[model samples]
Target: MDALTAEEADPVADEHGAHQRGGGPGRRPSDAQAVVPPGALSPAERDRSWSRLGDEDFDVVVIGGGVTGAGVALDAATRGLRVALVEARDLASGTSSRSSKLFHGGLRYLEQLEFGLVREALRERELMLTRLAPHLVKPVSFLYPLSHRVWERPYTAAGLLLYDTMGGARSVPGQKHLTRAGALRLFPALRRDALIGGIRYYDAQSDDARHTMTLARTAAQYGAVVRTSTQVTGFVREADRVAGVHVRDVESGAETSVTANVVINCAGVWTDELQRLSGSRGRFRVEASKGVHIVVPRDRIVAESGLILRTEKSVLFVIPWRNHWIIGTTDTEWNLDLAHPAATRADIDYILEHVNSVLATPLTHDDIEGVYAGLRPLLAGESEDTSKLSREHAVARPAPGLIAIAGGKYTTYRVMAADAVDAAAADLPNRIPASITDKVPLLGADGYHALVNQADQLAARHGLHPYRVRHLLDRYGSLVHQVLAEAADDPELLKPVPGSPDYLQVEIVYAASHEGALHLEDVLTRRTRISIEYPHRGVESAEAAARLMGRVLGWDDETAREEVRVYVARVEAERDSQTEPDDQTADARRAAAPEARPRLEATA
Candidate 1:
């Protein structure tokens, strides 16, 4: 290429040998480690993490990189414990990235009388809104349309009153009652006869994948070794006690043993599988519930706020995403593929049927720009309905030195992490300090509010639009400068990606270099969300994004071409799978494509 980006200038090459470009075909420049942002999960950082995993003894070894696993790593590291986190895939590659992207107290949980779960989640939401992740977590208003004229208003009002009393109303506005005409005025898309009145309330939403990745980065900053694409093959045992794990690098298929006092499995749906691999029985069995969501243009829903409707089995939400409306979430048991959960024709029809019940302009499959499915790891219960399973998390020391934590919502991940680490205290040699993650703001959280206030000035300085600056600030927080600075080598990087105007070219490069994106799918899907946000499903920008990512990760012509081909195949498979009638057929079609990580072994 022409010149090396800041993060690409590191001399260290990861185990895959992608970064060894000294006097080679596409040589760039010397080391510029100073330009690399703090807590950046660059290729060099991955190399360092691999070395640490093999050489150092850890107090805690966490097996997973979802929100909860990242949270545990952050909690353990902040408490001065020697910690290392390993993931089979990329960070937030599973359900963590595929969530409905809300940080609110579960309003639906109130009907089940789960007071403690709702209260704890509301507290976390407030912390994220005001103190912890103000840039990422944002306030969003929702309208609950009243169907029945008589008792519905009083019932919803009473429930919302309790919701507000339990810390849900802070940082955001409380509930507001409105007449049918007033509700119609606020949301013109709603049918006149759909409801008699409405109640509006506020909650918080986030980019779940970005939040989880940032958690891992923050954990790395606090002295935790975080490595992705490293799968735990088997457990390392010492007589009657579980001691450590044998992990294989999925990319290179290289094996290494990591010794630890305790191993915490936050593997989500893969919890039971990990327990089986460890030759131990878990305290609770985890059942996978598949939730499917569809994305459409923002204009499709003519509402300033989102909508929450009651379904026969569960509640349905038409949540507002940027430039799009994310309508979702059919909860059903999933016993198929855990890696790539497929959304079927039935699921899409169900969501459309429920959402269209209220909308004046009903949505068709043609209106959907994207479809995604995620699996929630619920604790198995007597009830067959997955929606009825409790969201409360459970932790257990299945073996002497192995701790498994499962069954929690995304909003309460920090609390879950604290609890998991606290469970490991008995096995740890030293008395571990209590969790201080609540007080520790993420890496980019500090000075975020100040930066938001200076958006215009920063935009002027960077030769960009004020709106673009604001968008970057919301996504990167104070690290907006770190992102924008990558354009110093090539001013063209400041321009937006082809076909995807919402994201800049530099952001794709940053994902590969600073955000631990090993594949083009990672950048397009999780890092920037271009895949689900656009009609072309990122195919329009696949080649361009791959080229941008290749520059930072040092991919040659052939490697870049292969990456594009794989991503295109995956997208096509997803589209084809969506047409399938049921889960089995959908999964078969979805699993037909080649995996980005070619050597990644199946968890089974």
Candidate 2:
């Protein structure tokens, strides 16, 4: 897949002009990333970033470390603006980490006639797969099972044909029509009578959490001051215009201020709350829609390709992950907790019921290893149905020095970020350069292909198995050398973690030392993905991970023990919550678990 420039790519995306343009980026494919070992988020780096925040007068300050905020910071930094990114918790600790892990053009949107959104998303997917982060985003095939007779086949085929050509779908193989027998051969797990035929199409998938983390790290390489465990408590106002942010270190509860020419809010579901704190009437309302998914072992579903089924309410995807299948996403209104959205028994049952309808062997509760829930910040509309809510984003300057961006899918975060920075340009002094992030490959992207070719030689040098080295290469790209460097002194760091043997022990150490993990949850949940991959959901690995984190973060034995206790309680809470009847009970149970980073009251 060759990444094409916007002008050469999809003319429809350009013609519609759905997303606001950032002045105009002077970018090209030949641009190289600046060489730097972006300050690792060790204890020392945290102090350094915090000190820099207190001392520097930045051009832009981005509040929210989700994909959009990280993208915003990167966009600003790549354009030669001084930038600071502060997250209340870990990066991608919210919706960014909890997505379906797809980098797809919304196929369902085609039904709603949202050609512009689909075109934009598909173009973005092209960039990620080809040029931007090939190591992170990968291609996957899906079988769209057809239930009805002739009309269904033709209708679906027409849609797939459009999907194939629009937004540079030529990057991957076009959709292939398959007979019922052929479909069954590809996915033997499906019941024979489940479909008449199917369409096999190519789409892209990724590790959302890792991609977001890498985005922030890449921004840091471009001189963006990235700080996690830092919360924006209130807005600093100089008369009517917003001047800066009043911040609190979630770890120390210490108060400080970050002065910036402009502030951009990409707080995801917390956008409304952040706007309220700024004392500005938000341009629009944000509705939180809860989505739930479950993880089951791969052997349970014997298939060569993934399956996408149509539900009465929406679509359900049985996506293939390594060693497991991620099946889910139940959409409904959520008003309880913004931080922790819990998946109830009903949500699990709904997913199981829909997925099992086609499976030859039904998957029971015992088959489920893990479950997670995330909130989608849908822009409110006249329709009461949350499903009808638009994924198209809106950017606004509600007050001077304040810019708010919200309402978009995970696929188009870059476009949204570009629009946001463009909207904040009014607060900037001179004419700022356009977003050059389009040309800037992320931190590990530059040498990814060459490293993949040298995997065997690299593995021999590192004294690790070929398979293990390849895994590291995919996850860290060229930065895998940095991770392996930790094992120079302690060779045992190369050993697999006690309970989670799929990942090396060194990964735990690297998560805290380099990836800005403030607590064990950051390692288990986001950094290494021990939580969702195992049957126990990191319960068995909590103490082991805590030990690794403790050594890096200077946590005493008691502190490490407490961290373990908190993680175990979190796993148990999620487990208990899944047994609950509805969202209210499940939210209550999930919220009962203690927060790893305690939030403080704001004093702006």
Candidate 3:
């Protein structure tokens, strides 16, 4: 290989025998210890960042604030590059937030003999669960139900043995083959006739949106200027190569020019659109594959471990959430709206029909508490089937100073980002360092286990329940104290939101104060997941939560009421849109909801 890819890059074979990833072969270099500021993104911080975007030049400006873009920003910044990460909407507002929420080696890929992809994903999963993000990515087990008797067990076991050993997957427990009775015991929801036995394997899951937001915060802590609700309108082209970006603050409608040595497009499903704007014919085409998921009560499926049922097209996962069972994902072609991908009645019914095949008591539409839809950016290959397209990503320098990355799973975003920066290496002034992100932990990941151990004491000190403190520790890690401190003077901040009791009022406040939530939609949808978790889809909690956020965002009474009204309308629109039969109808219904920040739509 001339120059190996990020995933294929060999670790240095030093005397210490350290197998560190993503440096040139046999290279182990030390990064300078730079003093980083607090990773807090208050309203004041957002203001300062917007002003800086107008005045300063950076080595790299990463477009898109999803996990991939955030990862790229962190990678470049840690290498001593002045980085700026901009997002048109909230972080993870697109595909990143709406996922099956698993960080695992793709099991189905084994059938395709994509051993290398599985190994890479599994290694990345181990890194996340053990070193990188213990606080976010946690171990989750899934049972693969066996239909056939004799050959099935051996065949599945062989694949699993490879899964266990190939990537050195040790952080989580290994695979275990269980008897029929044992499998039923672990997952009572499984039908006795559905299978003869099962294979239990350990993987990991996370709140994808939360994990992405944490990545942005972690990048900010490492001196990357992170700004959301900032849209890149056009490229600042000088002669042949791209020089910078023409940007607009979506919230305030203020236009600015930001000079950067290189521009990275990590704009997931919108990759083609950005490429069109750049007037560059990209190396590959990105097809938007729609995936729709439904959230039902946890009792609907009486399973201790999640179930992975084999579908004709793609796999269906009945994953376990806190109080709900998230069963979904229908992979079909979607040529609809990119921003708000609506789940039609057909999509919802398809999932219910398939999942109900094995359940003793089938879940009705009434059991559904939430509905969400997200698009996958699949690289269009020779096959027309989106599911048949490759999950492997490609990086291209279609132009001199622009690098675009698309078609990777959420589990391997770090590697994707590292490759993107490496593509931009030529434009950078100095020799950029290799990716140290594998060595550097996310902000809340370091002291998370210790915080969990002290959850009981923390609850007593804060006058809250141990369960609540444990929840806080998982969400904020060591920053739990800073979050709880906001509730010190005002005890009401400890009170739960009206419709969604799962989230506290302080979390809503903190979303605005520290999480860069510019609008009520950001709070309910991404920051807290109240929109999907609650039956009313955040309609009941919108007013109360908006009122709390108003205090932090300096919204007057009228603005608060307007925010509530807009959020309620958005919920109504979404619910109504779900009843539509096709993408065209659904898209029109979803677009009826007014944007939280009107200036954003106007400027666009």
Candidate 4:
């Protein structure tokens, strides 16, 4: 389906009756109304989007669709600015989706003496948990292993004390000290030699991809024209300033010009590339730091809480994500395909070796359910070591009407967005309003607390198990009702998808309709998490899932088969390459597979 033609159908108006007044089912009065549904963007609608883009000019145009760009669009739209957000691919298709999934103040930052960054992130974390997106972000506890008996406890305790005193930590429990035996009681999976004791502290986590998609949808609800699979081919310059952009409908190969008074580049790792396109000379460079994570079944690691152990290079986390545990992250420089970062065998071995050090029953490569890699948009420093580089982001106005933001962590996205918009506002003639996003709750956040309390009733009403309903609510909040409504229309949608037992068929349909999912990879890998949660990476279920999506995306039999084939091949290549020793060989093997069409390339 093409993006340009699809926009002309005004699918948003048709699927969600034009006169619909309040927020959709399961939403509160204060929540933003649902402007589009999971099935709103039909094939015809997608083919017509480019023509619509030429009809109107925006005050600000955001170049990337990662967390930062989505946040910028939401902020601009809420402030009554005419805004447009264009992504060359699906929303959150880059580093945004492949994050560590923590909305944290960076406990390690305290040791680095980055007090301001920690405080800012802590404030944003508080806002997200309490006011903004209560339905999506929640508290998660982590045990910091103490290898030494004496100074380790006191040193860690002091840090935890400071962490607790932070603004956002108020909603969660304070840190607790546990003896070796006490710690083992909480996590029997740990090896006796893994630690001398532990200190438990709190952080928060969310589905990064979903949160980013929600941010874009929320911006659309506030009157921003949000479109995905629309790539910015080049900049539209007027005199010496960037006036707008020339965007190509990636799916259809049709181009359109979008005029904007200001352009904010939030392309993460692609920051430098985008700046070059805009003819803006930037002061800093963004280096791609590759981090790979492995996912295993929850049963493999028996623990009451998550574990965080120190590695030779950086910290290693055994995070609890739904029914699975996510263990990861090796920091190394990557100059491979940014669209799909492959984890070499060495990367896998590194993670497995470190994580195995703490496990009573060692996990082999066969035990790994999934492997995924993401690039960190780190600001290049003098040191060659990527780990020592700054996690802090920078906002730059390299040219008139062009503002670029890069190098921040996920937790501090809002601050980065606000600063980017603030910089762009200087070029505009009108007086821009101050950011009220702190008080503006995301689409599903307003009534989340109330709906969570009624989980049992909601489950019974939907004929789902209570725990299943709780899971949906946690991910979608009040919007779970919208998902249920889709199932209400088709009984088959209520059934769980084959292979991936964790998600219902309706979730796949919702991805295309409302979440701006353009391709099969977007649905499986990002919108729903079958790619990371399932051992086969959804390869076994690819055909069935593709058929379901085909019904909505208007994919013919041949196209459906091709999508399944592509997704399957992607999985196979990743799995096969993980057996290769290093990044160069693994990257070459993974690169042998066909590149994803309509790829979203990030730029500054």
Question: Which lDDT value does model 2 have at 577?
Answer: 94
**CA-lDDT, candidates in order:** 0.87, 0.85, 0.83, 0.79
List model 2 lDDT by residue over 2-100, tens digit each.
222222221222111222111112211221121114534555657767888999999999999999999999999888889999999889999999999
Cα lDDT of model 3 by residue, 352-386, tens digit: 99999988788889999999999999886433332
Cα error, residue 233 of model 2, in Å, equals: 1.2
TM-score, every prediction? 0.94, 0.92, 0.92, 0.91
Whole-model alpha-carbon lDDT for candidate 1 = 0.87
Instruction: Between candidates 1 and 2, name the one with more favorable TM-score.
Output: 1
In candidate 4, which residue ranges exceed 4 Å CA deviation? 1-49, 381-391, 598-604
In candidate 2, stretches whose alpha carbon ends up further than 4 angstroms from where it belongs are 1-36, 381-391, 600-604
- What is the C-alpha lDDT profile of model 4 across 1-604, one tens digit per residue? 1111222322333222322212322333432333444223334334444555787778999999999999999899888898888888778988999988999888778888887778888888888888899889999989888898678788889877888887655778899988899999989999998888888888899999999988887777666777888888889889998899998876767788999899888888888788788887875688999999999999999998999988776689899999999998889998877777889889999999999988999999888888989999988633233221233777777788888788888998887788778888888879999987888777767557877788887777777898888888787776776667656547788889999988888888767655667688998998888998987888878888888777666678898888988888888898888889888888878877764563434332
Clashing pairs in 2: none
lDDT for predicted candidate 2 compared with the true structure: 0.85
Q: What's the lDDT of the predicted structure labeled candidate 3? A: 0.83
By summed lDDT, the worst window of 10 consecutive residues in model 2 runs over 15-24
